[model samples]
Target: MALAADFRHRYVTPEASLYAGEPTRCEELAELLRHILQMVDRNTPFRHGAYREIYEALHGFLHAGIGGSAKDGLVWGVKDFWAVWESICLVHVVNQNPGDILTCDMEHLPVLLSAPERRRAWLKQRALLFARNGIRRRPDLVLAGGDDIKVVDFKYYAYMRQQRRTAEADEIDKIEKDYLSMEAYGLLLQNHFLRNADARANRLSLEFWLPGAKAARQPSRQQPPWDPPLSVVHLPAEDLLRGYVALYPHLRLMR
Candidate 1:
């Protein structure tokens, strides 16, 4: 009770309050945040890290407002959404802790990261120190723990939709490209990263997370036809579509 009263007194007070211009809770909270940031001392190392985490939390909160509409603060265009998928996958890791391998029977695919490791932090689009054709390789998601560096590339492969059409030469070409890219990611990390020198290729575990039919059987080992210790994780199309609808409810229900 005292705390609540103190908060109201500090933040909600207005001596000559104008009835026509009362401050919204959102604006008031933002003002409070500005005050907090101004007061925070960034000189101390430990406190600086903690302050940084708090800033990220605030940024995330403001990135999307209370209402889930267009007017609700910052939003992204849906041109290329693999980045969004990468974020969602990271959430699954942070929330569910899928460990190194996913269970055969699971709604969400397991993440290559472990619980303690996931809690530390998951990175996004960190540029690898390798480049081909003057373009540096930046994987979608990355996590490092001890001798292991786990990397995941989210594929908006659209297999569920693509299955309707017959495979053609171009499709084969695309698949080959994707596999080769995954292989390159493993190699790039091994070259610069010195932890697992003996088994350079095996040091980093890379996987392409793709959407697939529930009827499709989960392979005990890696998903197939390609060889290179590459892995494939099949997330349910129904759930993925459901997630899309949750984010944008305009599209008709998936047939």
Candidate 2:
């Protein structure tokens, strides 16, 4: 079966042109995405019907007009795509190290609150606590080996190039706010794992994956004061594996 079927309507053509000069690299990316889909289909608990739902949604998103009535599907599809893509990348990276154990879609990590009442309240709030505006904040992938644990969060923007060149003030503001939200999510993960006795002494790292324009990382004055001190790492889609290895040297892939 094909890894990713071509959409009947192309929402973004420049995505092809973006790789105009690098056929090999483009092919590699396509294969990786396909492998990811196949692995998820074969190994994950999601059934064939679930895979169809994803494909149908992606198809609809691609065919819909920009800013059209199908905006919700487009948004959902983009988010789902990145979530799967990040999982695949992390799995590939960790598998390179035969000794490391990689876990995808990990859940039930304790929320950072200490008091039982506060934890209960946060749990009751649920979606409100985990979401900023309409965007949900959650860790996408985790890797553990020996005494170290790494939690990764991925944020994918398909039109980041266009956003960089032409996004208005309000749009820019929204992006900054999203970064702050991501920072909060990272801190939450770090604190949550640290509070666990088993993981307390383990090395923990939280990272944000933003595969966009170089300028996307420029410090913004509107950033939240409480944002974590860690900086967002700009990782081009093509170099995801390399960038990840650099950030977590302990999880290096064996050549």
Model 1 ranges off by over 4 Å: 1-84, 97-125, 128-134, 145-147, 160-172, 194-201, 213-228, 237-255
The sequence of per-residue lDDT tens digits that candidate 1 reaches over residues 1-255 is: 998578668666554232123446445555565565455534444656767776755554434233244321222323234444554554455444444322111112222223434333322223334455576665555555555666666776655221212345545566666655667766666665554355534556766677566624332253343333455667775675555435323221221
Q: What is the Cα root-mean-square deviation between model 1 and the actual structure?
A: 16.6
- For model 2, how does the per-residue alpha-carbon lDDT over 202-229 read when each residue is reduced to its tens digit? 3655555566544345332333432333
> How many clashes show up per model?
0, 0
Each prediction's whole-model lDDT (CA): 0.48, 0.45
Superposed model 2: Cα runs more than 4 Å off: 1-84, 97-103, 106-137, 157-174, 193-202, 212-229, 234-236, 239-255
Give the clashing residue pairs of candidate 1, or none. none
| Residue-level error in angstroms, candidate 1, position 151 | 2.5
Q: Which candidate is the best by lDDT?
A: 1
Which pairs of residues collide in model 2? none
Instruction: Single out the weakest 10-residue window by summed lDDT for candidate 1.
Output: 101-110
